[model samples]
Target: MKSYSVKELLEKQPVGDVVVINGWVKTFRSNRFIALNDGSTIHNLQCVVDFEQFDDALLKQISTGAALKISGTLVESQGKGQLVEIQTTDIFVHGKADPDTYPIQPKKHSLEFLREKAHLRIRTNTFAAVMRVRSALAFAIHSYFQQNGFYYMHAPIITGSDAEGAGEMFRVSTLNPKNPPLTENGEVDYEHDFFGKETNLTVSGQLEAETYAMGLGKVYTFGPTFRAENSNTSRHLAEFWMIEPEMAFYDLDANMDLAEDFIKWILKYVLDNCNDDLQFLESRLLDEEKSKPQHERSEMPLIEKLKFVVENNFKRVSYTEAIDILKNSKPNKKKKFQFPINEWGADLQSEHERFLVEKHFNCPVILFDYPANIKAFYMRLNEDDKTVRAMDVLFPGIGEIVGGSQREERLDVLQQKIKALDIDEKELWWYLDLRRFGTAVHSGFGLGFERVVQFATGMGNIRDVIPYPRTPQNAEF
Candidate 1:
């Protein structure tokens, strides 16, 4: 008999056919029926076994979380919930799991508790569904870029340039920390480091991907990015994946178009490919009101809202317009934001971003041409000299899921901007050389992969979407 995956069994519905299935027992109900799952899908296969058919020793080993191989006949059920089930004829115990030692039980476990057992949390229905959605979303990302003729570029893990220019970096070195490599003048010496220069885990892959885009015309990088910021918010993660796409001969408008299209593609792809997993998420994990359609449910309105966004085109607005709308808003007129929102030059706060997308636009909104002073040095300065050609794609729930901009290709303008920003021009020689040789107008943006996953799955936290999440003061595997 050929071994069958749980997912395969569910699809094949091989009633009366002998099939072999191997998996860890999720729940063994009454020692006669076993719920087996191979981490293939959110649904588990319930195998009904007769105690008389199995040896006493084999029966004793069958327990929840135990690994087992069972040969059985599939039976179509006219039951309440499950579609198909297996009636076991032969059973073999692959491994025994001690109930006391196993952390997960067939009971409700809080998300915080599950984080502690991160290694074992995949066995749960919620985590399993999340993992499946995560996988589908990742594929969707690759597919979206690939279909658009974007070459998948692998950026280096260790980088010398601070791409975000945020100054938050995790230094990489094998040298002693107490008395690290230093010059005679007592300054920290990077010459003796492994790379023979200062190197840190890359904060973003945008700069490196730009070099490839200039050559390949269109390129994207999907890779891990590290941020050493000590933020403990539900949104912050120390290490996360970012999908950065760089396009040659593109401006801010073209970049925004790409971002919106990419988001829509991924959202639609996951919804189509992971229907079963998504259903499980909607029914079990998401709130009851959120589970029902907007035409039916009142509590969870985001579902209907997102469905509209995925189907329709996003709204595009300028920074000046957003600020003006916020200032004249009726609801938040008296509310004071952490970062003051004024005219064209103000940096939009998360609350402002959320309000603009959720209330004003009532959908995904792309806000562009932020003040140059608030943006990075690489962003192209607009003719106004006050704002840079930067764009941020804000969604209903999450704010600024994507951030990108057109590069300042003009050498003189870039050099002057770098000098004004006080960034060492000598350190970015290769970047400047791109301009020196053959620099064409290019644009790119970084989409927080976890944030995108959270949006697609309706997952509440950034940590839940990622496996073994790296957060501030939390690195437990």
Candidate 2:
């Protein structure tokens, strides 16, 4: 009487062996068949019971969403759908979900509706498939870094410095809210705060990871990063998990190559390990997009799209070239763009990135050497002194999936850039010390983990890909 999972039971034909399985009833039909699932896999186990032999009181307890422990002999299914099923001999009701109030009913649910019931949404086939694929992808990320000799560094969540000089930060404070200590200039006294100074949630781990790379040769960080920007779009999340890998003695070209290869490796890994779950998601996407206009639907299947990325070469273009292309493109010439690309220094928006990746190239595109003023201060300034050695990887539907750049290893140039950008010199003194000691060429980039999951799963909203999406004014779960 060993406990077996539905995945294990389905995979193996234990024809005459009695196995104990515990799961929640997905659907109970005709007082005999119980569709049970344990979140192990997308497939459900069909448990057949004899109504004539079972008492009426016991049968009444087996309802949809009810948790039950069922012990039965596995047999070849006489049914048409699945290959195997369970013959229930004894049952124990662990918990019951009253159908009157259970939110996850057996029906097609809207993604928005499912977001509200985030705790129980995993019971659904779509979310379960997504999470399984997500797990596989996570493993693939760590595997790639570990195999390539990169130290997996854990950057602190609470940081004393702003990696991105944008100043969009969520403060970490333990001071009194109503009446806190004030300074001589009538400012809130941060000297008595948690860290004895102003501290905030880390916006990026790239800066800290660079410090490790200088010593370890190569380093990576996969952890939660926060932002206080209030972008309430389908693409924006206040909190996200990012994968950043830094390497010493690497130039911008080497950084671009690593980023491209890393993405392809993850895609191939998921395709190999999570085929069953990916197949379910592919079918889900096809059904979900059936009602949409034919012109708007994807030309290729989900799996084919992923395979295409792995098989093909990414189009690499410089920022100056991209600007020239955008300014003279059919969309810009015809004034169809939402924000028309008119000049070289204009920051590329989502619309522009999509135009380049989906329309112009019809493939993944990596744009590099961005205008220095448009990028972060840490990016290496080019010989022209106007552009930085920055790069962004844009996918067909998801614009800017990955972004990274070569660091300004020269202390004099970096200090000047920080000063010109009005960043505090004292705050980044240790970062500058890396340059002082032995800074050679170093480069890195970060890719949002949730966005990659969304792409792999063909999920529509970014919120749907993450387990508990922390968006603006929405932290309910």
Candidate 3:
């Protein structure tokens, strides 16, 4: 007899063969049936045991959350819903969980309650399925990039330059916090710090990946990025993973095409490969929305929503046009929008972005050519001198799923932008070198990895999809 994982045993279904398996018991019903799970699949393998044969101590150890090893013969299950069962002949208790002390029970628990038990939440069906899908999505992302002739680049985590220019980054230093060196101006002297100058965790890897793209022709980075934004919303996180891809000689149009195709491809992969987990998630979402009013419920099931994106073409509209639509739209005219859209050059919020995708367009929308003042300084300035070649991909549920642009390749224009923004040129001296020596047109985009996982899993809160979510003032695990 050989040990087999629950997933493998369930798939192979070798009836009449004796097998050995180790797993944590999910439930012990009537002292006869044991529901065994090994984090291999959402389903549990039912093991039938005759209580008369096992010792009283061993029988008591088969309670939920206890680890056990069993040797049994596989047979066709007399029970419904399951295909096969284990007829146990021997039992070994590896560990025991006191029923009164175990935090997880075989019952429905709220997401909020499970969040506090982050370390043991994976034993639940919901988190287990979400994590499995997250893993599949990660592998699919790499597969798509590799098959499309893109090199994976590893960007540095700590840097002296601000990539997003948002000035929201976690500081990385070894200096004493209570008393630190001060400069002549009475400011904290970063010169005496570990790096000799101020350094922080990178908020984005786009700037570094661009350097690689210029040399490698095409490159992508999938790594953890940090931000110090003090937002306590369900969508915000202090630390998250980012997927950024940069390509040389690609204009804004080419960038939009790549993003659209990439999103559709990866989503379709999940839809095809993760049917079981997705079905479970879809059912879970449907049950969750039942309490809400009819209007608040999703228009379609989770799987259908994903298929909608993969099947349909994203409607491409300009920022100017989107503003015009929002200005005259029913929401703005009726004073329903919280942040009303009035004119151009106004930054669009999540409400506006969601409106463009869900209400106005009824599909995924790609809004491009944003006003130069609202976008980052690195975007290519349009001929009108008022807008930049920046674009955002908006989905039905989430506002901005992806953001990218054709970078400003003109050395003079980039320098002027940097100067006007009051950024220290010394920090980005190496970045400017690429332009001075051999600059070519390049474009890239940053996609929030957790956001995608949340959308795919139909998980309402962004924190639930990630394993160990790091948020504002909440690092319990």
Report, for all candidates in order, the number of backbone clashes: 0, 0, 0
Each prediction's TM-score against the native?
Answer: 0.95, 0.98, 0.98
- Report clash pairs, candidate 2: none
Q: Which ten residues in a row have the lowest lDDT in candidate 1?
A: 296-305
Q: Encode model 2's per-residue lDDT on 1-477: one tens digit a residue.
A: 589999999888788898999999999999999999999988999999998878998888878889999998899999999998989999999998888999999998899899999999988999999999999999999999999999999999999998878888899999998998999999999998888999999999999999999999999999999999999998889999999999999999999999999999999999998888989999988988899999778767899989978987999999999999999999999999899999889999888998888788888999999999989999999999989999999987778899999999999999999999888899999999999998899999999999999899999899998899999899997
lDDT for each candidate structure: 0.85, 0.92, 0.94
Higher-ranked by TM-score: 1 or 3: 3
Better of 1 and 2 by lDDT: 2
Better of 1 and 3 by lDDT: 3
RMSD of 1: 2.7
The local lDDT score (0 to 100) that residue 423 gets in candidate 1 is 91
Off by over 4 Å in 3: none
Candidate 3 per-residue lDDT, tens place, 58-139, comes to 7977788999998999999999989999999999999999999999999999999999999999999999999999999999
Cα deviation of 124 in candidate 1 (Å)?
0.6
Candidate 2 CA-lDDT value: 0.92
